[model samples]
Target: MHRCLAVPEIFSEILKDILPSDEPRLNGTLTSDACHLSLEGRPVVESSEELYQTLLALACTCKRFLEPSLDALWRTVDSFWPIFVALGISERDLEEMITRHRNPYYPRRNPYHPHLSDLSEAQFKELALRLIIDADYNKAQYYLSRIRIFKLHAIPSALLWAVGELSRKWGSPLLPNVRELHLTPPLTKDYLIFCGRRLVHVSAPLSADSPSLTTHSYPNFDSIYIPADNTKDTNDVVSSFIKNLPPMRVIDAVGCNSMPGTLEVIAAMSSLRSLSIGKFPDLSSSPAFLSPGRLLPCLQELLIGDIDLDLCTQLLYALEDPSALRQLHVGYLSTTGATLQKFMTTVATRCSPICLTRFTVSSNGPRRSADAELPYSSKIQPIAVQPAALQPLLPFVNLEYLNINVFTFNYDDGFVESIALACPNIVTLCLNEHPEYIKSRNLTLRCLYPLAKYCPRLESLNMGGFTFATGPGKIGVDGLSRTWTHDERYDVVPGLSLHFLNSSQVGVIDRCLVDIAAYLMDIFPKIRYVDYHPLYFHIRDVREPGWNDWK
Candidate 1:
């Protein structure tokens, strides 16, 4: 009653239900009755092309299968292609795809039935440019153009030059669009010349004779970081670079021995907002940089290291008005008790009323007494404050953050109280590595309750090296003690709390973890994150031969 069907015909019907219809080969082959019968028992197509063929057969059978098959084929494309195949994509197509989406990769084509028409010349050129740079340069360039951030770690000169040339040729006026550029390089001149106008933020280790070094117009640049290794002549080169970059707002010259002339140039840059002279030679010792108020006028944030009170005083006086300086950080510097007292007294009187908002002072110097021979029986004499002391900072009533490190045999409660009184608007306080005098005479948690009561807006408190009250006979307890509990009268301030405890020894670490956990749950319930730096634990499991198997 019916004509016998071939293997191909049977197979065609089965594949129509399983695969999409756009695939061409199977559509043409399955028409014969013998082919249908041959494929009758097969359940699945094994390879991509086989699947594609099956879908093509379905598409030819009915127009309804065409759209779905095309969609499935396009969706499977990804970035990984063989070396030769990636090189084949044309530049124009690549650019078109990149402009439409952040990432673009090619779809697979069968070797026997190649579809080369899809590839464009533009896409190929773009790919070629990237390939010529870093082995991974194509991906890096994609991120740079699309994401606006790039960190080029040790780029080779030849590769850098090639990419620069390609960028110049094809890039739009704002084509590169790089916002942050961190380049550690064996860079060439061409690379720097190409990058100068486009880069807004830059971090690099530069040398005076570096071929990539340039003194050119760079209007958009806002931040620059120079290593402190620059020689005297190199300082001139840096100054020349700075002159070209008028928009620069921040400079970090940590460890760079900047020339005295460079300091003058820095002071002259009215647009400079923040500066760091960390761990450099004492600029204060050089009369050329210190005389006639050689300080950056517009600088709102400053970080200095290994300086002295005289230099500090010089800086305060150099400012058009000390009140305008909002934030200050001094570290690894030494100042005599007399000099420190004088400086503080001056700040209390002058900067107390105006713009200074933050202050941080620290030192690693040895502790000694101003007057060591005085015994417990003698009356303490008030230190005299000179007129020059009053010439420095007026008290800063609007001060928001204050961090002080005092190292001395005698701690003075009056000094701490004075600072707090001067900065009534304080929001954050950090006191650490103080001398024994301060430790012995330090204000207790109960004594500092006034700060919480008065400073309602306070957000963070750091009482460095804090010890809790211990047993009845002991004056101070370990951090775990429950003896020092907050009362109903005390308000719960919403803020971060940090505790530093001894964890170097095994016994200490075990004890500390238990105490720390208990304290966190009971006393400091507001903590958001815990950071533990175990000095004793070496993490032997990571280096073990069978670590992967163990996991």
Candidate 2:
């Protein structure tokens, strides 16, 4: 019943189906030879937009294509906002779409519409609410109000007002989640008062004309860091702020100026566990507020920067029971031989037996030149530590860290040996020698050899301003020319000598590594993490004879 058609006949049939039957024909000629050809295989859609246009075109073409095209068009909508604007949709459209399919992705809406800047506030509010309700509440809160996380600069009042209103209405019971809150100048007393109860962590920058916004009932804060920019108003405001704080755990008054009643109030806060006071101008003035006896009884960590040694000793002595003081950091502004010895002796005796886990002291004065000579022996006191004197520090066997700054030393071997013997369990040790002393005569390896012998558990060691030699003959020399040409190889100690590196000089670093590797291969076998600072070379246990392969 069916007859196979030729190619020409098939082409004519396709043209007839595509064009209208009423169309005029050219000379009634059979133009099937000029007809367009269909390619083999399936049709390929170009992109999402092209697919959507194709579906829309199909839907307009005939009733047979309407259902499939509409289905494709609806499924191509990625977000509610785009679909809404595209379809000229309203809030009711959103409601219907959400009701039918409850799993639509809704993007955050921008309150200010770019296309309709002239829209009234009521319209903006309605649109904002609709968008807000569709978005996940947890994510919307970040943009909705209270906390301003981005842009440290000041915020405009309109945005602030909107955020504040939203916060008061919907952000109650739960505090705003912000990492840092900085309240600066130009803010009124009412603004500060309103933010005080909601903010849990705050940094207030005070100015001369700034109002003292200290309220008796303050926010439930856990930490406060105040910056004292050398201003009278700042000092006054800081004092007032501390007076009104809830029982806090940490307070950092690192650079605040000396306030009349500030220190006294801080000392009385029983809940403070850690405190730092740095760069105070007058330590010897003996203000009524400086009472360590009342202040530091329960402190677990205390850091006093750039204070006179005498004042430091006085403060340390004030803490009659320093059992709770586990960490101490002091920066010496004034140091002398007698004062230094007195401070060290006091710590070794009075505070050593307690749980003092870390101790650090630094002198920030300029280093003397290499050519500068040390004071004469007649003016220098003999460096000696009697055995009975060190008995008090035997209780510090549990200490894990120790750092000391030595400006002048007698270069006596016994003194270094005593330190190494006293703190055998130290894991981290930093010994900073004055540059003048390192460059002076009598700087010896014999003095420091005790460290490698005594500190078995030491994981990190820093020795600045010193030279390293290959053999015992050049141990006491000031220059490297005396130590480089030794014939015998040195054994590097493991666990004993694993992480050995010098940040001093190239010649010193190279020679030290050569000797250290030899020592490790010959004497200590468990060494790892050897760093040669000048060469920027690091060697670990995975590679044996690590340095020889390097060109």
Candidate 3:
């Protein structure tokens, strides 16, 4: 028989309010003094702090919260040493670990297999071993058992090995409660395999250089983020880790160009739904690495960068009924207008047109000579670079978001009408961004009115480079509104809600840039924020409901 203690309730009750949640939201504010107002009479404060500090402070209030607060404190740890040190592991122990693994002849074989992960057997043996252990040992083990999330950032490779070996020796998990694991550079997969199904989410900057294991399984890993690593061993690392896993639902391989053949292997997996790759396969160099089997029927989100016409031909030439793909973001290493035309045409002819919901194309703008001059910092006048040929993209009726900002092109003013006609379901539209050109090549604000009239659900629009200077001269409120009035709110957005315009920076405002803050809100009505360049507006007075009346 042993003594037992339990708290009827914990600090979690106290923290329910302060933690981020949907209800009881934090509202915006504005100052009364006119001097404090920066842009269009709104108070602007310049400061920032880590969000968790508030929770940490509140936990310090009650003495009864000591254990509960400690549990919360150790819930999400970045480095393993904090928990290990809190557990009373000595510096000498750490030194011994580094020394042992550095021996070069140290036997790296794992003694205990994956089946030893059973909680009942492992916990009993560890308890029997620690029956007469010190009070400090009890405290250390208690905290180590509470860690729910662990994110290792460039930790010593030997330290990981030590934890793996020491925990296995004691028949307990090194981190018993870890639900998620993020490693900056994982030296080995032994630590991961050791945790078994306790690990739910894992992200690491993985490459071919990490210690490869031929036989291991992580059944519960549903989401994984594998950022690019420029190491030499692409094939072995991907195969060693990926082939043995349970079916994965989400895999993000953005910026992973060096890992050749990795994307195709992931695509073939039956459970794969979301995948993002750094670049499409360069068929000119590695045509043999292409996928020969059935297409990725389950794939829904495919964000591939640095693709050209040749790769477009290789990928979509023979594919059929790829109707499952819903979202796509295709970037380019370099592309010509003609190349884009061929690619789009091929997409229409070869693939299923019904499934697309969101699409984006990024561009590395054409190389300009030194004499290129404009208000743009690089002095390069963005030229209209629309594709030479056009086809009706009306088949993609389910399309909701369309962005082609980076690829510069010039097309007739009717192009917007065509887009509005084809994609009636579109909520966000971002056209190309080109510097102001002569009247002969320019399209005006009035031409976009049809887009507003047709697409009643259009939530956000970016006539990318349609500056006041670029468009038909100086059209303000009436013209900007485009007769778009709905539910007593501006009809520019769907249900009078707008989230983002461009990604970050705003386009040029040639006339009365000072009133832009007030102008955008009045014209769009639902816009809460704007990301314009050369001027940043907090827009507190207009955005916050009663902020102005506060002072």
Overall lDDT per candidate, in order of appearance: 0.46, 0.47, 0.52
Residue lDDT tens for model 2, 1-551: 89999966774564344322322121111121111101111122224345545555766876666644443333211122332232233545444333332122322332333232232445434543444334334544332232221112342232234334444555441124332345553434423423434444455555444453332534445556666575454555666766656666667766655453566666677767776766544544655444556555667777665567677777776664556777777766455666776777777755744588777665642111211222322323323223343334456766667655455443334654666787776767655545555453233445445555566566555444444442354334233222222212335332432222333445655656544444333322344444453323333432444565657
Tens-place lDDT per residue, model 3, 385-419, is 66344453557777888766443567555777788
lDDT of 1 at 424: 58
RMSD of each: 19.3, 23.3, 13.3
Candidate 1 lDDT at 145 equals: 35
Q: How many clashes in candidate 2?
A: 9
Compared with the true structure, model 3 gives a TM-score of 0.60
- Model 1 scores a C-alpha lDDT of 0.46
Clashing pairs in 3: 87-140, 384-409, 384-410, 385-409, 385-410, 386-409, 386-410
Clashing pairs in 2: 490-518, 490-519, 491-518, 491-519, 491-520, 492-518, 492-519, 492-520, 493-497
Question: Candidate 3: lDDT of 192?
Answer: 66
Runs in model 2 deviating more than 4 A are: 1-163, 171-220, 227-240, 281-293, 365-395, 409-417, 441-457, 469-505, 520-551
- How many steric clashes between backbone atoms does each model show? 43, 9, 7
lDDT of 1 at 386: 31
Error of 2 at 388 (Å): 12
**Alpha-carbon error at 88 in model 1, in Å?**
9.5
Model 2 misses residue 521 by how many Å? 7.9
Query: How does candidate 3 score on lDDT?
Result: 0.52
